[model samples]
Target: MIGQGFRGPGADIGDRPETFAMAQALENCSKNPIDPEDGTAIMTTDHAQPPRAREQFRQHLATVLADLQETAAQDGEAVALIGSLATQLSDKFRQASWSRAKDAMSADNYDELLQSFEKQGNALHQAGRTKQAYAVQALATSLVAGTQRADTVIAQGEGLLDALIDRSVALYRQHLAKRH
Candidate 1:
């Protein structure tokens, strides 16, 4: 409970920016809950994630994409159709995010949720939250753009689903095998 009751630097958790984690910590557990044998408290941070977490996520992403590719292959026309859809959706998505129109994705009323998802996903990847970023990308991949297919939308907007996922997996796996 050391960090509790005291608003140390960077302890800001809410609007007041004081005694935030303190309250949660106080409510969650004993002042010094320790095991009779070990006599120590476990410490971890939700915001500060480990690097391997991303590597694992990268692996998971590769698996999901590979599975998706296999499943998509069953549709016969899915690859070609989705590629075409990807192109259209990417164009529209770009128009929404980067174009000068007031109705763009950046606009308050237009697809704000999607904008948030894309921005947050990229930020996650940048912050070593690769798994979460991949999840976000996967979410976007499942969402349709107007009448377009979900796979096509995500593919056209950022990358071909199969290629992006495959490359990310290989890179992460290699990195994982290298060092801590």
Candidate 2:
């Protein structure tokens, strides 16, 4: 199985430099696998990620949020657009996580096995973390636009759930691959 440490970089989204460094180290180790007894394969190092990628991800997230906000502001189109945005956001997260997991696993860093597991677990947990917040904001926006209704709210919630299923299936495939 691919080591978990290699998976850390994709999942690390915090202010701590140390965390990023550790994740980078794990990624490096995965890329350059060495004998466990050899001191050359160190487990930790200070590695900085490219700023451009981070900025891009942040911008993408902002764009999604803004789009959801704008969609909710509409009256007749609220339900349809909200459903579509939620589905799109959910797909984005799933694709991102799958890409990360695949990259980490392909690195072949044995030391990162545990960390990869953790990343998988954490990714699964936070898969839909933004959905609740988005739904709330969407609901608020809908209310402001006089589009609030139990049916609309429930439909939005159901659409989000469907998105979660897509993510879950992708994750499960990764998990199954690791197991076999």
Candidate 3:
């Protein structure tokens, strides 16, 4: 019993208080068979919400909108991109209807789409689609120029929408890190 953590027939039931406590702990664990360190049940399901990048992007757009209202910021490629994103994200957020799930892609999938925005645009652009070609060219230009002129980017056809999002996320994170 001493070697086996005082379990299964030790002659003395009345031992040190510490020994009784240890035995009680072992009995409780045997009865429960759960990991106690993390204070979490083993059979629980994760109910966490999705990543909030799109939501954050929406808020960022609102800030831009406010800035525009107050004449604190000028519209640019970033504005154009943000406007498009606002519309799309609105649908995803179910602002229009409850049945948006069929048409809406998940935020993770949307992020992936942005990452391959160039490739996807080029695929259509190369097929002699006039509008697509224009968009691809514009997005490429915005990406190469390293500027956030959202209007021109949208108007010209397409620009590196993913890069714009990535850049915004990085900048926002940097700002937060500094604030902390």
Candidate 4:
């Protein structure tokens, strides 16, 4: 009913019913409500933007990861700093508008990455790696915040997410090395 008079056979255009029906279908898809939690639409409205956003996110993620790798190399134990970073991550995520990067990626991808960090963080905590655990949890929080923020500025968000993931992975690796 929404796109009825605009694109389908009911419209003024002399298009075939099947074609118009397909077009209507597409329109409906694009209009599907976004997931309130993730702020991404069920169907991407702009097909062209997703690839660009995804590529930009990937590049930004890479750069941040590189920076995080460097930071991890010079790692120190700063419990206060980790707590503050975690709080920042939470605040940023809560303030972000996720709709901007909705088509950039799938929720599963984000979930998988975040889950990995959480799993690693808990393990580290259980093994008496408090600093590393806190850091890893903060990293997980950053990924959500970064992805949410990317909707506003892709590069900035990607960089943040990338850096967080890189740091989290590095910490996890360090824990593994110590365990073995």
Name the top lDDT candidate.
4
lDDT of 4 at 7: 20
Mark the regions of model 2 whose C-alpha exceeds 4 Å error after superposition.
1-49, 75-78, 81-180
2 or 4, which is superior by lDDT? 4
Alpha-carbon lDDT, every model: 0.34, 0.33, 0.31, 0.41
Stretch of 10 with least lDDT, candidate 3: 1-10
Q: What is the TM-score of each candidate against the true structure?
A: 0.27, 0.22, 0.22, 0.30
lDDT of 4 by residue, 1-180 (tens): 111222211124333222212123222222334578878644332333354444543443344344444544555443233434443443344422222222243555445545456566546544545455445533543444343332445445555555444444445445546889
- Name the runs in model 1 displaced over 4 angstroms: 1-49, 77-85, 94-180
Q: What is the lDDT of residue 130 in candidate 2?
A: 31
Question: Lowest-lDDT window of 10 residues in candidate 1?
Answer: 1-10
Report RMSD (Å) for each prediction in the order shown. Answer: 21.5, 18.4, 26.7, 19.9
Top TM-score model: 4
Candidate 3 lDDT score at position 138: 27
Better of 2 and 3 by lDDT: 2
Judge candidate 1 against the unseen true structure and give its global Cα lDDT, from 0 to 1. Answer: 0.34
Error of 3 at 135 (Å): 4.1
lDDT of 2: 0.33
- On the 0 to 100 scale, the lDDT of residue 112 in model 4 is 51
